[model samples]
Target: MTIRRALISVSDKTGIVEFSRQLAEQGVQIISTGGTFSLLEKEGVPVTGISDVTGFPEILDGRVKTLHPAVHSGLLAVRDDEEHQKAMKELGLDYIDLVVVNLYPFAQTIAKPDVTYEDAIENIDIGGPTMLRSAAKNHAFVTVVVDAADYGAVLDEIKAQGDTTLETRKRLAAKVFRHTGSYDALISDYLSKQVGEPLPERYTVTYEKVQDLRYGENPHQKAAFYRKPLAASGNITTAEQLHGKELSYNNINDANAALAVLKEFDEPAVVAVKHMNPCGVGIGTNIHEAYQKAYAADPTSIFGGIVAANRTIDAATAALLSEIFLEIIIAPDFAPEALEILTRKKNIRLLKLGEFTSAAERKPEWLVTSVDGGMLVQESDVHTISADDLKVVTNRKPTDEELKQLLFGWKVVKHVKSNAILLAKDDMTIGVGAGQMNRVGAARIAIEQAGEKSQGSVLASDAFFPMGDTLELAAKAGITAVIQPGGSVRDEESIAVANANNIAMVFTGVRHFKH
Candidate 1:
């Protein structure tokens, strides 16, 4: 089918003038509405208004312009079918060979911090989507274009073949449905939030692709990175990569885990993560000391791990970091001399994430996880433990210094995978046992790693101890104090074990289980 007539209506006017001029030079009649018509006419392109074809004036603030029968019949007619052709001839309806449309800025309007509900509703495009759907439904005879970025390729096809190919039309039609689906999903999400329903009866989300990663967790699987349209600022997804090789899937995962642990501290802190588990975490008066303490916590595990620092990294810290074989290093900022040294290692990934914000400052609204065939959605775990929430169950109470170390261990254990156990002293983690099958196994692993350092250190568990064995192991390891949620059926047994060993124990009344 050679090009004869085309309809153009768009909110974004980029490339429309030149595109329409090319169509006009090909002897294709241009039919437009509202601003599109005015712009095409000003550009010296011959165009006809919707009223000229539909024989009806635009009313209801331009909402009733393209909903007329003449426009729909022309777009929906099948040119190859004799009956459809006869009806079109009887109604004097011309064939609309192509449709160029883009929806209103509904997503952009609602993204504004102070946009009103009324303004959002008014920005929803009604007739534009209707025309697009009509043309897309009859893609065998009609061509539809929704994205302005595809204008050049589409114009080239039309100029070479006098019309778009059947394959191109089909692909364009599929794109139209995808465009409308995402548009409607954004509107649904906005309205649901307006009514205070963060999770609706039917949840729908759309993401724009950020980049395709080198590979997934392994070398064979393919993966890409995507971000929500209105994502909050200062997140790992928004971090800027200053210098390094492309990030692999595992690199991003470990980096994100490191950042989460780093956010728990307000002072200069460093968190070293391996396999998405915190191997070492430490806080110091300066970033250099913090890095040294964290590295000393577990030198073997820190060999190929990712490190995240809450403060700017200085030249001394950078010099030490370069001595290790690390996959990635993330910090709020890097001093000029520090960058000069770190950039020497071309393969090490360095990210500059400015001004770390705690979860309390910019909390996520929901936590979404994917399963085999379904999705699980729930509120994010942002609960914080305080001194008042602690319940001392054992006869012996923790001293003020022990209480501080217990809280520090508690924060670090939350980021570790369950069954998780962490040992800490002086606000620095000495040992971490993560992803064990049983609480006793995790406790033993952490105790063994701590060695003689376990003496006078406090232990934190992600959940309550299931039985007295974990407490018995901690007692033998010389663990002085422990913090855990106390709701297990065997809580009394564990308390008895703690009392027998004269170990101070506190119940947080909250669990921090990570999977």
Candidate 2:
């Protein structure tokens, strides 16, 4: 049988009433539970309560509302099968052709600062997921709509064809599985946290679909944007694009790296990122000056790089930016005139990420990296090390200025892929060596890029140097001090090499391994 009945139960009621009314006009019966039942009745739509259809009153504080056999049998019944039809008819069950449900606000609930254990447990949904899966399992005979945002498409299809096509049912069933899987992942995460295990049996991540990209990194590869759940108030994903064209795969990747680096500084800061690595970073009195200094650090690299500013972009900054061919620009706010001026470059993406300071609103369990046949998963690198955390291992204590440069180098090195080396002067990154095969190779690249700028510059390594050869090379480049997360067995060899040249050395005691 075609979908002639829909069971609508939702925590988010957006477009529900209008959608129900439209469904009613199409002569489809609307069955609902508790709040959905009263709300639909108030909206002047004739609705059958789930309790009435189940032939049992909703008990256990509404937990037992839609769990009865009548609902599941109706949703799962195959109208084309004689046995299924006979059983449903014997049980007096009307086929529930569509299921519209959204789970409880569990993510939002847990995010509250004072959320209690009871509150978190109570928000775990029971009846809604069951109905969604039931309808989805029988997708050949039913359509399951989990997100209210899909209401328009489902309604439009019914209105256009007088019934949804078979293909639409299968597509929606895929979405239903994804929805329930994400929901189950959240529950598992919350329960695991309560048990206080460093790693769980299964690590899961839930991301909402943002958009389907034109293509992935290449034209042949498929790709889509999935916004991480529990995003901060001002995260880039939550930011609005006030002007310009849609963002590409590389644009978003580089822009996110730029924003992440910019979040490390408190002062007015700017970061220029190319190929998911920071090419230049600077801090100054104001955003305008910061952008100028960051750009001046490496103008050639900043040409097509994403620019991230910690503060608002004023007219002065905008005017100066107009001279460059930037891919995207992100800021806390953009002055009215600044936006108008920036909009002149119709292809440049202008993003306003207000109040989002990259302090990590919600941390994820693990990161997934794909290979040809399978993926590698590991815990996210949330290990943070500050200046106070470093231990001065060399005889010579680093001067205040040198310490600042070391910290600056440390910040940039973490963002770079291993094996990584960064050389910094004042408070900005001058040169970086990333994704090399060995520490010595990375050091050579960093020194070559720094050139004369390597003199008196502090060097930071992402991991401990296995040999003192890199330090010897860095010393030849006139490097004064070195900072690394030192746990190497031959750590003394590196320290001896640094001390031999009167270079100050500090061990962060924590390594940032970005593979």
Candidate 3:
């Protein structure tokens, strides 16, 4: 197919002028719409307007410009079909050999904090996607380009072969559908949220690739990172890496876990995560003391784990952190001396995140996971419980200090995987046992990890105890109080055991099963 006339329309004008100039130099006639026509003409590239080609002026605020039969027939015509060619000639319709188009910035517009529905609706591109779909449907004859990144390659192919190859056209056509699919998905998602339909009849989500990691949980698995189009700030995806090698799959997961746990505390706090579980968490008067308490929680598990701090890391804390072999350290900011000290360990990944906020304040609308042959989507678990929400289920009520410790343990337990158990005293975590096959197994591990520290400490279970075994185990370990969601059918048995052991227990009426 020889190129004669090409249509160009785009929202992002990156590299378009140069690309149009190259096309003009190749003796290809350029027909563009509105701003693209003006831009090309201003750049000294000869261009024809859509009004000249279709004999129709843009009307209705430019919404009715390219929806004419002249544009669609030209793009949809089959070149080799004699009947289609004859109909095109009879109607004086000229074949458009190529289409360059991109949709309006609808995602970017809606991402603003104060955008209105009227503002968002006007930014939706109608003519662009229509022309793209028409050209893609007839890719055997009409070439379509949707991405700015593909401009140079398309221009090079045109310069080399006078027209793009069939294979290239097919690939570009496929890209057009994928691009528009994501575009429509964003619109659907936004409108669904606007209408108070969180989970729509047909849920759709789209993400742009952020980066390809070195590997997944294991080196044998391939993996990459992607982010939602309008994802909020102050998340692991938006964090800035100040130093060290590229983050691995495990590094990103652990970093996110560390951040989630760090957000639970408003005071100066430190959280260390290993295998996506909070192994150590502490709140203190200063970042240094927090680091000390967190390191004291479980020193062995802190090795090679990711650490996050709610407050600025000071020189003293950095000095202590550098003593350990950590995979990553993330904080809102670092003191000058702290940065200087931590930078000495060249291989450790250092991240400087801005002001941290709890995910509950600005939660993601959906949480999606892949299973077998489909996806499972649900709202994020941003549910929080206060001390007042605790319902005493045993004869012995928790003391004021025990209630505080139970709340602290509950916060830490939420981030741990099911079957999860966390033991805490004061405002620090003493032990975390996560991802066990059974609740009692997890309880045993947490108790064993706490050792002598388990005395008088509080325990938090992510979900209800299936039987009295976990309660018996906690009582044997000297756990004076326990907090858990109480919905199990064997709840009475667990409560009986708690009362028998003279241990105080509270039911949160909510569960935090992370898995």
Clash pairs for candidate 2: none
Error of 3 at 508 (Å): 1.0
The candidate, 2 or 3, that scores higher on TM-score is 3
Best by lDDT: 1
TM-score of each prediction: 0.94, 0.90, 0.95
The positional error of residue 402 in candidate 2, measured at the CA in angstroms, is 1.4
Instruction: Please give, for residues 200-292, the per-residue lDDT of candidate 3 as tens digits.
Output: 788888989899988999999999999888866667888889888899999998898888888777778899999888889998889899998
Tens digits of per-residue lDDT for model 2 on 205-254? Answer: 67897888888888998888878777665656888898888887777778
**Whole-model Cα lDDT per candidate?**
0.91, 0.86, 0.91
Q: Which stretches of candidate 3 lie over 4 Å from their true place?
A: 359-364, 489-492
What local lDDT score does residue 98 receive in model 3, on the 0 to 100 scale? 93
The full ranking of all candidates by TM-score, starting with the best, is: 3, 1, 2
Candidate 2, residue 488: the lDDT equals 87
Residue pairs in steric clash, candidate 3?
Answer: none
Model 2 scores a TM of: 0.90
Clashes of each: 0, 0, 0
RMSD list, candidates in order: 2.0, 2.8, 1.9
Question: lDDT by residue for model 1 over 1-515, one digit each (tens)?
Answer: 79889999989999999999999998899999999999999999999999999999999998789999899998999888999989999988888899999999998898898999999999989999999999999999899999998899888988998899999999999999988988898989888888899977898878878899988998899999888877655567888899999888899889988988888888889999999999989999999999998998999999999999988889999999999899999999899999999999989999988875674574656778999998999876667878889999999999999999999999899999999999998778999999999998998899989899999999999999988999999999999899999999989999999999999999998888999
Query: Least lDDT summed over 10 consecutive residues: which range in candidate 3?
Result: 356-365
